[model samples]
Target: MRYLFSFIGLVYSSLIKLAVLFNPKARMMERGRWKVWGKLRGGIVPGGRHIWFHAASLGEFEQGRPMMERIRAEYPDYRIVLTFFSPSGYEVRKNYEGADVIVYLPADRISRVRKFLDLVQPEMAIFIKYDFWPCFLLELERRQIPTYLVSSIFRPTQLFFRWYGGAYKRLLHCFTHIFVQDEASRILLGKHGIDPVTVAGDTRFDRVISVYEARKSLPLVERFAATVPEDGLVIVGGSSWPPDEEILVRYFNRNPKVKLILAPHEIDKEHLLQIISHLRRPFIRLSEATESNIDRQDCLIVDSFGLLSSIYRYGQVAFIGGGFGKGIHNTPEAAVYGVPVIFGPRYEKFKEARELIAEGGAFTVSSAEEFTSLIERLISDKGYREAASRAAADYIRTHAGATERIVRQIIR
Candidate 1:
C-alpha cells in the first residue's frame, strides 16, 4: 500500500509540474520553495524551543492563525516556523508577522523529512485541518515529536475510512491529539481506533473576528471607504470563483444602481477577462481606478490582493464563493462584517455554512435560479437584509475562541 501510495504521489507530482509550466501560479510556487531554502540557509529560524505549523493554503493558514498568535503570546521564547504544502498560502503569507520563519514543506519523501526534522528540531508540530503528508508524519512519529491536527473533520467518504485505507487510517494515530470540528468527525476517528479526540470547533471564527477588530484603526481603509456613498448599499463578493462571478455579474446587471465590489479567487488575466466579459454595466478594475474614479462606475472589479477582508467592512450583502465547487470559502470573513452571505449548494463539508444557514445568517442555492432569486430579494428588501446581517454577526460571535481551546489541550 505504501509503495502504491508513493507511485501515485509521483504521478500526481509530475502532472502538477507540467501544469505549473502553463500556469501563472507556477512562479509563486517556485518562488515560495526558493524563499524557504533561503530562510533555512540564512539562519532565520530561531534555534531553541520552536513550534511548527503546517497549512495547505490560504484558508488553512487562517484556520491556524489564531493558534499561532496565542502561541506567540503564551510562549514568547518559542519561535514559530510555518510551513506550506501549496504556493498559494506561503506566497501570500511569506512575510507574516507572528512567525519567525515561513517556508515550504519539503516534498514528502523519507530523506527530505529526515533532513527537515534535523534542521528545524521543533518541539511540537501543528497540522491545521486536512494537510497530512505521510512520509513527514511518519518521521515525526518515529522521532516522538508531539504532532496534532487542529480543527479537523473526518467524513465517511474520506480515503482513510474506505476498506482500502487501513494504512492511511493507521497514520491518523500518529497525532498526539486530534481537535475536530464536529461530533461526526470525532465518532469517525474513534471508530478507526484513533483516540484522544476533542471537539475544538473551528479556529477560523477567531481569525475573522480578529480581522474585524484590527480593522477598527486602519487609516487607509477609512480613506478608501469614504469614497463609497454614505447612503448607498454595498455588496461585496469575496474570493469569488468564476461561476460565482458569472452569477453575480448577471445579478448586478439587473440592478445597475447597486454598488458592487468583486474580489475574485484568482486575479490572473484569464479570470479577469472572464469577469469583464460577463458584466453589462460600466465596470472599473480596482488597479486602474483612482480615488477620483470612485463614482465613475457602478461595479469595481478588484484585481488587487490583501484588501478583501477590509473591503467587507463596506458590505451590507456578502457573497463568498468556492461553494459551487468542492466547498465554500470563508463565511466568517463576511459574517465578521455583519452581512448576509449567499452561496451555492456544495457546502455540506463546511460546518460553519450549515450552522449559519440554521441561524438564518446565510443562504445556499443549488442552481442559478435559486441564487438569483434570493440575492434579488435580499437586495430589494431592507428589513430582510438587515435581519440576516444581524444574524450573521451573532453566529460569528458565538463561535469564537476555538484557538484557545485547542492550544490549551495541546500544550497540556
Candidate 2:
C-alpha cells in the first residue's frame, strides 16, 4: 500500500510539473521550490540535529508557526526545516523568519523521501492538521524518527474509520503522538488502537489571540473613516466569492451609509470587473488608485494579498467569504479583530463557527434578506455591536496557547 501510494505521488508531481507550462499558479509553485532549494545549497543547515515541520497549506502553516517558534527558542542547536505540500502555503510564507530552510515537500516517492531525509537529516518530524501522506509516514517510521501529528481533527466519515481502513489506520501507529483538535478525534484514533492521544484543541485559536493582542491602528483606514463620516457603518466583505458578492450586491445597493471594503478570494481582473458591474455605487479598485484617488471613494476593493487581516481592524462588521461555495475561509481571522462576523450558512463543519455563534459574536444567514436585515440592525444598535465584540474578543483570549502546550509535551 505504501509503495502504491508512493507511485501515485510520483505521477501527481510529474503532472503538476507539466501543468505548470500552462497554469500560472503551478508555475509559481515550481519557482518557489527552486528558490528554497537555492537556499539549501548555500549551506543553511550543515551538521546539526534537525526538526522538520510539514503543513498542507497556509491554514496549517498558522497552526505550525507557534510550535516552530517554540522549537527555535528551546533548542538553539537544532535546525528547523519547514515543508509545504501545497503552493498556497509556500508562496505566502517562503521567507519565514523561524525556519532555517522552507521548501516544498517533494513527491512522496521512496527515492524523493530518501533525498529529502538525507538533505535535512531530521531527528524529529511534525505533521500539522489532516495531511497524511502514507509513504512519508512509512519512511519516517523506518528511519526511527519520532513523528507527531499536531492539531489533528479526525471525522468518523474519514477513510481511517471505514472497514477497509485497516491499512490506513496502521499509518496512525507510525506517529509517536497525535495531538488532536477535539475529543471526537481522540475517540476515533483510540478506536483504531492509536493511543497516547491528547485533545489540544485548534492552534488557530492561539494564533488568532496573538493577532488580536498585536492589533494596531491603521492610519490609512482612519483617514478613510474620517472621509466617510456620513457612512456610520463599515461592512468589511472579506474573502468573498461570486455567490457571496451576489448577496452583498443586493444589500450594499440599498444601504448607502454602510461603507464597504471588499477583499475577494481571487483578485483576477475578470472577478474585479464582475464586482464593479454588480455594485450600484461608484467604487475604486485599491491596486489601480493613487493615494489621492481613494479619499473620495465610498467602496474600496482590495485587489492585493496580505492586507485583509489588518483591514479587519477598520471594520465594525465583517462578512467572511467561501461559506456559499466549497467551505469557508478563516472566520477567526476577522473575529479576533473584535468585530461582529456574518457569513452564509453551510458552516456546520467548522467548530469555531459553532463556538462563535454560541458566544454571540457571529450570525449565519441563509439568504440576502437575512444578511441585509442583520447588517442593518447590528449597525443601528450600538449595544448589540458592543456585546458581540466583547464575546468574540473574550472567546479568542480564553482558547489560546495550543502550540505552546504541544511543544511542552514534545520536549518532555
Candidate 3:
C-alpha cells in the first residue's frame, strides 16, 4: 500500500510538471517548490521547538487562522511552521505574520517525509480540514508526534468508511485527536473506530466574527453605499464568478435604482473587462473611486483584493458567489454584518449556507428569476428583510467560540 501510494504521488508530480506548460496555476505549484528544502533550512532553525500547521488552500487557511493566532499568543516559545499544499494559499499568505516559517508542503513520498520531519522536528502537527497525505500522517505517527486534525468534516461517502478502505482508514488512526465541525462528522469517525473525536464546530465562524468587529472603514465603500437612495438598496456581490455575475447583471439591469458592489473572485484585466461589458449601468472601479465624486456611480466594481469582507458592511443584502460554480464562498463574512444573504442553489456542501437558509437568514436561488424575485422582495419589505438580518447576525453570534474551545483543548 505504501509503495502504491508512493507511485501515485510520483504520478501526481509528473502530471503537474506536464500541466505547467499550459496552466499558470500548475506552473506556480511546480515553481513554488523550487529549492523548497533549502529555503526551509535557511528559515527554520535546526532542532527548534516547532508547532506545525498545514492548510490545503486559502479557505482552509482561514479556517485554521484563529487556532494559529491563539497558539502564537499562548505558546510564545514554540516556533510556528505553516505549510500550504496549494499555491493559491502559499502565494497569498507566504508572508503571514502569525507563522514563524511558511512554506509549501513537499510531495508526499517516504524520502521527502523523512527529510522534512528530520529538518523541522515539529513538537506537534496540526492538519486543517481534509488535506490528509497518507505518507505524511504515517511518518508523523512513526515518530510519536502528537498530530491532530482540526475543523474536520466527514461524509459517509468518503473512502475511510468504505468496505475496501482499510489503507485509507489507517490514516485516520494516526491522529492523536480529531476535532470535527459537526456531530455527523463525529458519528462518522466513531463508526470507523476513530476515537476521541470532539465536535469543535467550524473555527471560521469565530474568524469571520473577529474580521467583522475589527473591519476597517473604507471611505470609497462608504461613499458608494451612500448613493443608495432612501428607497433603493446596495447589494454586495462578493467573490463573484462569471455565472454569478450574469445573474446579478440581469437583476441590476431590471432595477437601475438599486446600487451594486461587484467584487469578482479573480481581478485579471480580461475578467474585469468581461464583467464591465455585461453591465449597462454607470460603474466605477473601486481602485479609481475617490472621496469627491465616488457617490455618483450607480455600481462599484471592486478591482482589489482583501476589501470584500469590509465592503460587506455597506450592503443591506449580500449575494455570496462561487455557489453557482464549485461551492459557495464564505457566507458568514456577510452574515456577521447582519445582512440578509443569498447564493446559488449549489450550496448544500457548505454547512453555514445550509444552516443560514434553514434559520431564514439566507435564501438560495436556482435561476436568475429566483434571484431577482428574492432580492426585490427583500428590498421592498422592510420587516421581512430586518427579520432575516437579525437571524443572520444571531446565527453568527451563536456559532462563535469554536476557536476558544479548540484552543483550550490544544493547550491542555
Candidate 4:
C-alpha cells in the first residue's frame, strides 16, 4: 500500500506539471511551490520550537486562522510555520502576521516530505478541516510529533470508512488527536477505532464571532445606508456570481422599497461590467460614491475587497452567493450580524447552512420568484424578520468555543 501510494504521488505530480501548461490555477500552484525550498533554506523559520499548521485553501485557512492567532499570543516559545496546499490561501495571506513563516506546502512525495519536515522540524502539526497528505502525515507520525486534526467532519461515504480504504484508515491514526465539528463526526471516527477524538465544534464559529466584534466600519457603506429610505431595506449580496446576481438584480429592478449591494466573487472588469449591465436602477461603484452623490444610487457595487464582511453589518438581509454555482460563501459572516440570509439552491454540503435552514434563519431560492417572495415576506413582517435574525445570532453564539477548546488542549 505504501509503495502504491508513492507511485500515485508520482503520477499526481506529473499530472500537475502537465496541467500547469493549460490551467492558470495549476500554474500558480506550481510557481508557488518553486520557491518552497528557497524559503525554507533562506531562514524563514526563526530559532525556536516550531508548530506547523496546514490548510488546503482560503476556506481552510480561515478555519485555522483563529488557532494561529491564539497560539501566537498565548505561547511565545513556538514559531508558527503556516503552509497552504493551494495558491488561493498562500497568495492572499503570504504576509499574515500571525505566523513566523508562510509558504506553499511541497508536493506529497517521500523525498519532498522528508526535506520539508527536516527543514522546519515542527514540534507540533495541526491540519485544519481537510487536505490529508499521506506522505507528510506518515512522516510526522514517525517523528512522534504531536499532531492534530481540527475542525474535522467525517462522513460514512469517505474512503476511510470503505472496506478498501485500509491505507486511508491508517492515515487517520497519524494524528495525535482529532477534534471534530459535531458529535456525529466523533461517533463515526470512534466507530472506526480512531481514538482520542473530541467534539469541539467548528472553529470558524469563533472566527466569525471575532470578525463581527472587530469588523471595521466602512464610511462608504454607512453613507450608502443613509441613502436608503427608512421603510426600505438593504440587501447585501456577498461573493455573488452571475447566477446569483441575475436573480438578485432582476428582483431589485422591480422592487422600489429595497436597495441592493453586490460584492461579487470576482471583481475583475469583465464580471463587474456584467453586473452593471443587469442593473436597471441607478447604481454606483463603492469606490466612486461620495456623501454628495451616494444618495442618488439605488445599488451599491462593492468593487473592493476586505469590506464585504464589515458591510454585512449595515444590511437588513444578506444574500450569500455561489450557492447557484460552486456552493455558498460564508453564511455565518452575515448571520453573525443578525440578518436573515438567502442563497441559491445548492447548499447541501455546508453544515452551517443546513443548520441555519433548519433553525428558520436562512432560505434558499432557485429563481427570481422564490427570492422575491421570500425577501418580501421577511421585509414586510417585522416580527418574522426579527425572529429569523435572533436564530442566526443564537446559532453563531452557541457554536463558538472550538478555538478555545482546540488551542487550550494543544498549548496547555
Candidate 5:
C-alpha cells in the first residue's frame, strides 16, 4: 500500500508537469513550489516554536481562519506557517498577515514531507477540512507529531468507509486528534474504530460571525443599498455566476423597488459584460462608484474581491451563487448577516445549506421560474421574510463557539 501510494504520488507530480503547459493554475502551483524553500528559509525563525496550518483552497482557509487567528492571538510565542495546496488559496492569501510564513504545501511525496517537517519543526500541525493526504499524514504520525484534522466531516461514501479501504483507512489513525463538524461524522469514525473524536459544530459559523463583527465598511456599497426607498428591498447577489446573474439581473431589471448588488464570483471582462447585457436598470461598477454620485445606481456590480461577505449586511435577502455549477459559495457568510439566503439546486452536498433550508432559513430554487417565484414571495411577504431572516441569524449564533471548543482542546 505504501509503495502503491508512492507510485501514485509520482504519477500525480508527473501529471502536474504536463498540466503546467496548458493550465495557468498548474503553472503557478509548480512555480510556487519551486520557490517554497527560499520563502521558508527567509520567513521561518530558527529554533522557534511554530504552528503549521494547511488548507486545500480558499474555502477551507475560511473554515480554519477563526482558529488560526485565535492561535495567533493566544499563543504569541509560536509563529504560524500556513500552506495551501492550490493556487486559488495561495494566490489570494500569500500575503496574509496572520501567518508568519505562507507558502505552497510541498507535494505529498514521502521525501518532500520529510524535508518539510525538518525545516518547519512545528510544535503542532493542523490540516483543515477534507484535506487529508496519506503520505503527509503518515510521515507526521511516524515522527510522533501532534497532528490534528479540524472542522472535518466524513460520510459513508468516502474511500475510508469502503470494504477495500484498509490502506486508506490507516490515514485516519495518523491524526493525534480529529475534530469533526457533526455527530454523524463522529459516529462513522467510531464505527471504524477511530476514537477520541469530538463533534465541533463548524468553524465557519464562528468565522462568518467574526467577519460580520469586523466587516469592512464599504461606503459606496452602503450608499447604493441606502438608495432604496422605505418600501423597497435590498437584495445582494454574492459570488454570482452567469446562471445566478440570469435570475438576479432578470428579477432586478423588472422590479424598480428592489436594489440588487451583483457581486459575481468572476469579475473578468467577459462575465461583467454578460451581466451588463442582461441589465435593463442603471448599474454602476463598484470601482467606478464614488461618494459624489453613488446613490443614483440601482444595481452595483462588485468588480473586485474580498467585499462579498461584507456586502451581505446591506441586503434584506442574499442570493448565493455557484449552486447552478459546482456548489454554493459560502451560505454562512450571508446567513450570519441575518438575511434570507436563496441558492440553486446543487446544494445537497453542503451541510449548512441543507440545514439552513430545513430550519426554514434558506430556500433553494432549481430554475429561473422558481427563483422568480420564491424571490417575489420573499420580497412581498414581510412576515415570512422576517421569520426566515430570524432563523438564519439564529442558526449562525447557535453553530458558533466551535472555534473556541476546538482551540480549547488543541491549545492546551
Candidate 6:
C-alpha cells in the first residue's frame, strides 16, 4: 500500500510539473516547492518547542487561524511553523506575522517527509480540515509525534469507511486525537473504532465572529452604503463567480432601486470587465470610488481582495458565491453580522450553510427566479427579513467557542 501510494504521489507530482506550462496556479505550486528543503532548513529556528500546522488552502487556513493565534498566545515559547499544500494559501499568507515560519509543504514522499520531520522535529503536528497525506501521517506516527486533526468533517462515502479502505483507514489511526465539527462525524469515527474523538464544532464560526467584532471601517464601503436610500437595500455578492454574477446581474437589471456590492472570487481584469458588461446600472470600481462621489454610483465593484469579510457589514442581504460551482463560500462571515444569506443550491457540502438554511437564516436558490423571489421578499418584508437576520445571528453566537474548546484540549 505504501509503495502504491508513493507511486501515485510521484505521478501526481509529475502531472503538476507538466501542468505548469499552461496553468499559472500549477506553475506557482511547482515554483513554490522548488528547492523547498533549503527554504525549510533556513527558516526553521533551532532548539525551541516547535508546533506545526498544515492547511490545504485559504479556507482551511481560516478554519485553523483562531487556534493558531490561541496557541501563540498561550504557549509563547513554542515556535509556530505553518505549511500550506496549495499556492492559494501559501502565496497569500507567506508573510503572516502569526507564524514563526511559513513554507509550502513538500510532496508527501518517504524521503521528503523524513527530511521534513528531521528538520522541524515538531513537538506536535496539526492538520486542519482534510488534507491527509498518507506518507506524512505514517512518518509522523513512526516518530511517535502527537498529531491531531482539527475542525474535521467526515462523510460516510469517504474511503476510510469503505470495505476496501484498509490502507486509508490506517491514516486515521495516526492521529493522537481527532476534533470533529459535528456529532455525525464523531459517530462515524466511533463506528470505525477510532476512539478519542471530540465534537468541537467548526472553528470558522469563532473566527468569523471575531472578524465581525473587530472589522475595520472601509471608507469606500461606507460611502457605497450611504448611496442607498434609508428604505432601500444593499445586496452584497461576496466571493462570487461568473454564474453567481449572471443571476445577480439579472436581478440588478430588474430592480435598479436596490444597490449592489459585487466582490468576485477572482479579481482579474477580464472577469471584472465581464461583470461590468452585464450590468445595466452605473457602477464604479472600489479603487476609483471616493468619499465625495461614491454615493452617485448604483453599484460598487470590488477589484481587490481582503475586504469581502468586512464588507458584509454594509449589506442587508448577502449572496455568497461558489455555490453554483464547487461549493459555497463562507456563509458565517455574513451571518455573523446578522444579515440574511442567500446562495446557490450546491451548498449541502458546507455544514454552516445547511444549518443556516434549516434555521431559516439562509435561503438557497436553484435558478434566477428563486434568487429574485428570495431577494425581493427579504427586501420588501421587514418582519421576514428581521426573523432571518435574528436566526442567522443566533446561529453564529451558538456555534462560537469551538476554538476555545479545541485549544483547551490541545493545551491539556
**Candidate-wise lDDT, in order:** 0.82, 0.84, 0.90, 0.89, 0.90, 0.90
RMSD of each: 2.5, 2.0, 1.2, 1.7, 1.4, 1.2
Q: Return the lDDT, model 2, position 289.
A: 57
* Candidate 3 runs further than 4 Å off: none
lDDT tens string, model 2, 84-150? 9788888889888889888887777888788778777888999998788888899999999999999
RMSD of 4: 1.7
lDDT of 4 by residue, 89-150 (tens): 78888888888888998888888889998899888999999999898888888889999999
Write down the lDDT that model 5 would get.
Answer: 0.90
* The 10-residue segment with the lowest total lDDT in model 5: 1-10
Clashing residue pairs found in predicted model 2 = none
lDDT of 6 by residue, 270-367 (tens): 88888888888888999888877787899899888788999999999999999899999989999999999999989887888999999999999999
Clashing pairs in 5: none
| Candidate 1 wrong stretches, greater than 4 Å | 1-15, 18-20, 44-47, 216-232
Per-model TM-score, in order, reads 0.92, 0.94, 0.97, 0.95, 0.96, 0.98
Can you rank all candidates by lDDT, best first? 6, 5, 3, 4, 2, 1
Question: Which 10-residue window in model 2 sums to the lowest lDDT?
Answer: 222-231
Backbone clash pairs for candidate 3 read none
lDDT of 1: 0.82
Tens digits of per-residue lDDT for model 5, 1-412: 6667767888898899899999989999999999999999998899999999999999999999999899889888989999999898999999999989999998778888888899999989999997778888888888898999999988999899899988888899999999999999999999999978999889999999999999999788887888797877998999888888888887888889899898888788988998898889888999898888687788999998888888899999999999999999999999998899999999988899999999999999999899888877887899999999999999999989999999999877
Model 5 misplaced regions, further than 4 Å: none
Q: Candidate 6, 41: how far from true, in Å?
A: 2.2
